[model samples]
Target chain A: SQTIHQWPATLVQPVGSPLSLECTVEGTSNPNLYWYRQAAGRGLQLLFYSVGIGQISSEVPQNLSASRPQDRQFILSSKKLLLSDSGFYLCAWSVLKGGGYTFGSGTRLTVV
Target chain B: TQLLEQSPQFLSIQEGENLTVYCNSSSVFSSLQWYRQEPGEGPVLLVTVVTGGEVKKLKRLTFQFGDARKDSSLHITAAQPGDTGLYLCAGADTGRRALTFGSGTRLQVQP
Candidate 1:
């Protein structure tokens, strides 16, 4: 079975600080990866998606950026965080042939 | 842009009660999926309806796709407290690799 892992299940960062969240999937290759953020009491908003290594598509314009360094490794980063950047971030993966996607445990980031 | 709109943004009911959540869209979808997310966790896939007017059941949860493929619904029979979570509907386009998700419906089942 495939499993997705996200680092720093919870994070507390100071305003203007750098941010880095990592997501890795095991047991699958060349899977589609996505980054999503959910603010308190709000639905999820897609931030970025990667089809392959070095290929990323941004769904929304925000301070965050995404990178696919390896086939199974995806990273979400920001040079300087803002208070509005605080939210629950999720990493998801889907097979190119499937109709459903699987998500990781998620990272709760709080920018104070 | 294609979008899925869900109704009853928030639902609160007692355990053993029944409820239904609806997802509607003006654009057709190739496939629709239902997911449940608990606090501090990622959304988990519950079911997917592909063909128009298709209905799928998973235990107490039943999912139905509209005949036009532009809407869907999730019905929970005799809900349990464990079912309390955020319910989301996502649609996949015919040629797109990504899905457009609904705003979501937060369901609370009190025991």
Candidate 2:
């Protein structure tokens, strides 16, 4: 009965503005969490993943960073957003290695 | 890093037609998974093939894993409009915890 919640469903931010997208999981403990970004036409790209709190592994180097403030809460942030940062962001969790992952509803971010 | 190549980047077929999509990789995988994603939503797990040369059927969809553990295929029989979506193939290696996903195949089944 695990579920993930990602918010602000839709966001529009001005260029060089700050950004923060939050994701939290319920009904699971110490699960592997991941962040993915999907751009138009291009497929989903892995941004970051965490095996535990404060243990984030970034896959792609960009103007973004991730933090696990709590066991189930993950935050994606950027000091200054860029036009290229717009995309559909997804959060996912998995209990076992190489196992099926349950994804969140996702957040659509548009950097103007 | 394992790389998966999915062909037929885009596919459009009429309902009741049969089609097959492939996923090939140069590196061996401990497991392979297929997912379906709709617009405005995250991808959902469809099936996972573990054992080499394993074939699993889910209703009208069939999945096959290559004997060398380096490739896989998905076949849909009598496809329906509901089957239209983006199909992605991901492979996992025993040495790596993360999965390497293919670019993806966008499928459209016309009603």
Using lDDT as the measure, which candidate wins? 1
Clash pairs for candidate 2: none
What's the distance in Å from true for residue B14, model 1? Answer: 1.2
Q: Go through the candidates in order and give the clash count of each.
A: 0, 0
lDDT tens digits, residue span A60-103, model 2? 99999999989999999999999999999999889988888888
- lDDT of each structure? 0.92, 0.91
TM-scores for all predictions: 0.97, 0.97
Instruction: Tell me each candidate's i-RMS in Å.
Output: 1.6, 1.3
lDDT of 2 by residue, B1-111 (tens): 567889889999999999999999999999999999998888999999999999999999999999999999999999999999989998888786677778899999999
Work out the iRMS of candidate 1. Answer: 1.6
Could you tell me how far off, in angstroms, the CA of residue B11 lies in candidate 1 after the best superposition? 0.9
Angstrom error of the Cα, residue A99, model 1: value is: 2.3
For residues A1-112, write the lDDT of model 1, one tens digit per residue.
8999998999999999999999999998999999999887557788999999999999888888999999999999999999999999999999863468899999999999
Write down the worst ten-residue block by lDDT for model 2 chain B: B92-101
How big is the positional error of residue B108 in model 2, measured in Å on the Cα after superposition? 0.6
lDDT per residue (tens digit) for residues B43-79 in model 1: 9999989999999999999999999999999999999
